[model samples]
Target chain A: MAETTWRPASARGAGGATATTRAWRVWSSAAIVTAVVLAVLVVPPVVNLDEQAVHLADKLLPPSWEHPFGTDDVGRDLLVRCVYGLRVSLLVGIVAAVVATVVGTAVGALAAACGGWVDRIVMRLVDVFASVPHLLLGIFIVAMFRPGVWPVVISVGLTHWLSTARIVRAEVLSLRSRPYVDAAISGGASRWRVTVRHLLPGVLPQAGLAAVLMVPHAIWHESALSFLGLGLPTHQASLGTLVQGARSSLLAGDWWPTLFPGLFIIVPTLAIAGLAGAWRERINPRRRSELML
Target chain B: MLELRSVTAGYDRRDPVVRDVHLTVAPGEAVGLLGPSGCGKSTLARVAALLHRPDRGQVVIDGEVARGWRHRAPRAQRTAFGVVFQQPRLSADPRLTLTQLIAEPLRATGRAAEVPGRVADLARTVGLGDDLLARRPHEVSDGQLQRACLARALVLDPRWLICDEMTAMLDASTTAALVAAVEGYRARTGAGLLAVGHDKVLLERWCDRTVHWDELSGDAAADRTT
Candidate 1:
């Protein structure tokens, strides 16, 4: 008898989401899978090609079957360099995002759970952090350390955690007000127990969503730092380094070098963002019905 | 015994909802708290349950004054009473199965080993089918979920029970089932109860005595007789 009452709206074909959202979800999932597969399987072998092996004879080669993304001014394979650059950018972005998410979730949960002067102090700290432009702060932090992956990751991770903290704090505050949480408290669960068992689990998905969404931003932050010559050393083939190296070639009218690396950065960023959007839609109870379609 | 002594409480301390309310329920007694909607009956109920701290006045349990509210409350004091809120859906962890939800307090208090047995026993008592034990709140009807909530409230064998408009959202059959379940638990445990709602006939039928909100607060008697 209960079964008859819970026929999901999607099952009844009466959900609110339109075909456009449905299409977007499909495309987003596909893009994410394709990007991950490329990063894992294809990029590794492509990156093995000698990025610094210059061939003056083959300099500024345009897109051809022999040199797909064309050769750079140093005559090194642009395709190989771009693939290597993408791998580095993804590695930094993912690591930095994870760091930011962990810090944010902890801060957010602590601030909310304590809920007094602690909440106020933490929120004020978050505001202080948010007031600074991420890029500007990131540049200063990165400039302090040696030009490498760790410095860029640290800068991006530190600079980007404010939003996730704010998001997580908001989520925790709302969850705390929930009757279930109140019920848990009334049930003799200690403050620590309620936090660990109920509050943490409740905020995890929102934190995860925040983490996924932050990946593209982290990537962009890393790329910007690298472009400003304050990130990864020029010897390393990050997407930003490749773009920076292509400035001269671009001026000489060999646009392929700059364009290809730029494309590499944009495509994966959009793909990750798309995946995050689809994930957000899936977790939302109202939109979850739409996913079945 | 459960007692609220001259309790004045609300979301805002300065502008209290229920002022200087005094009420009590001895063991084995069922007291209905009758009030119109927005009369602060629910807020008073929360105070009685120790889920909310009154702006003023004491909540005495079994002649002992209650000191803390929520998780800070002593385990013996906190676990002595079980509260069933109005919305079973909102009062339940949506992700947990019915069995898990019913067994929550047991696990919360480090009695994990007793969960399966207690949950099974309560399920049977609440008339929850074996098949329904594995379902989430969204999978069940409001009535079915309320049954689970009743089972949960009684699972710990609490000395006191507070049902704050628990049946307000349910159909007649479900409400009767829940009331009967509460009655069975009370009969077995001799637990005191504070049933808060505006349903006069239902309260009159289920509770030993019904008290008006204004009467409890010592206000000038209004036309609150149902």
Candidate 2:
């Protein structure tokens, strides 16, 4: 046993203050929240076909302000539809990613903590699921369930959960080895208590970053499936549906309908990707330390 | 009193770190376990603290086999013995503040309501003030964290404090101060202590009697008394 050394209050306080400041710099909690809020607010009101009005009569008109994004053969507002489509696409992406992260993290934590046969079984199942291409798996699931929001959400969520599960499992495995975990055990903490209080908190920052990164991935997959006419029901307007409808007219010199919606999708996608990059930089200690110097 | 009757235990099955060893610490006695680095001092400490089960013989406390009392012991009985590790980092959670770390044993036994006063008292005794109590483990110096760990070990006022190389990481002055603090506590409460260390000088100065594992193993047939 070693003798306990006392540190002066001021020195200890300074150390704690420095650590907290560093943590705040690394996280930028406010910036993340603001990005999320901006995404929520800005993407919904942008309409693509507002400039072209009389093109409603022209059926499929070329790009012109009268129906700024031109007109579909059905005389619909491509701009309005694109704006609404952005909302739907973002909604599906976020919902699917969140569901996947939650379910995946829970299953992964359980498998890692309980280990032995349970761990082996869970990992084998994860491997089986991971071996299949997620897009193909999602398409198969959507086909089986019939196309709808929930089905697409579930399909993408279930298919993409392998990555999240793997990340969480690795984190939990490492956390279990720390001496504080042993200390918690010696203090008569139940397995569940240790997992929830110690293990989960340690892994949460990483999981959160992973969850954010998965959003764009899920969105892209969903869009691709929808563009192929496999996602989002017939009446619903997603960016993929808009793109699917506009593909036939691209050759007729009517690029406004597709171009406008594509820009809308790309802009948000890039923004989200940027935010994810920033978040990773903040949460990762190695990166944060580099920035500090 | 805690006793080990020819206990054998180790991380692996084949190579027992603590060989067949018999030792005892009577009630209210401060005994130091002295040995070299590879002599299994910590393993023996773990056995006494019930953190590990010996592969052979019995860990007997108060004339009864301790295995039977494992989960059946009362809360106070469980807290009657506290073990501190060589690394203070290992003893305390890095995420916890000094106050939380020191108050952990109290909270563990459902005595959280008594934490505020007890924490303040322990901090004062260990020379950790209000400011240090608010900081997390990594934020504080190693010496300060070790002091917090010591305070945590004593919060429940355990009868047997098993410290395994507890002062090995500290500077000389800090170690000396801690030694004096332990001595003061022992004088005041008359609690039994099992301080394990490789430093013979520390053992001689801090403990009433020194017990070496080699000596215990060398003369197994002799009825040894310390």
Top of the candidates by lDDT? 1
Output the lDDT of residue A267, model 2.
Answer: 62
What tens digits encode model 1's per-residue C-alpha lDDT throughout B119-216?
Answer: 99999888999999999999999889989988988888899999999999999988888899999988988999999999999999999999887788
For model 1, name the residue pairs that clash.
none
Per-model TM against the reference:
0.90, 0.79
| lDDT of every predicted structure (CA atoms) | 0.85, 0.76
- Candidate 2, residue A12: the lDDT equals 25
Worst 10 residues of 2 chain B by lDDT: B68-77
> How accurately is candidate 2 docked according to DockQ?
0.20
Which candidate has the top score in TM-score?
1
Interface Cα RMSD in Å, per prediction: 1.0, 3.2
In model 1 chain A, the worst 10-residue window by lDDT is A284-293
Tens digit per residue, CA lDDT, model 1, A15-84: 4555566576559767765876577468677556676788999988999999999998878888878878
* Residue-wise C-alpha lDDT for candidate 2, range A56-124, written one tens digit per residue: 467776667865676676777766666667767888998998989998898899999988899999999
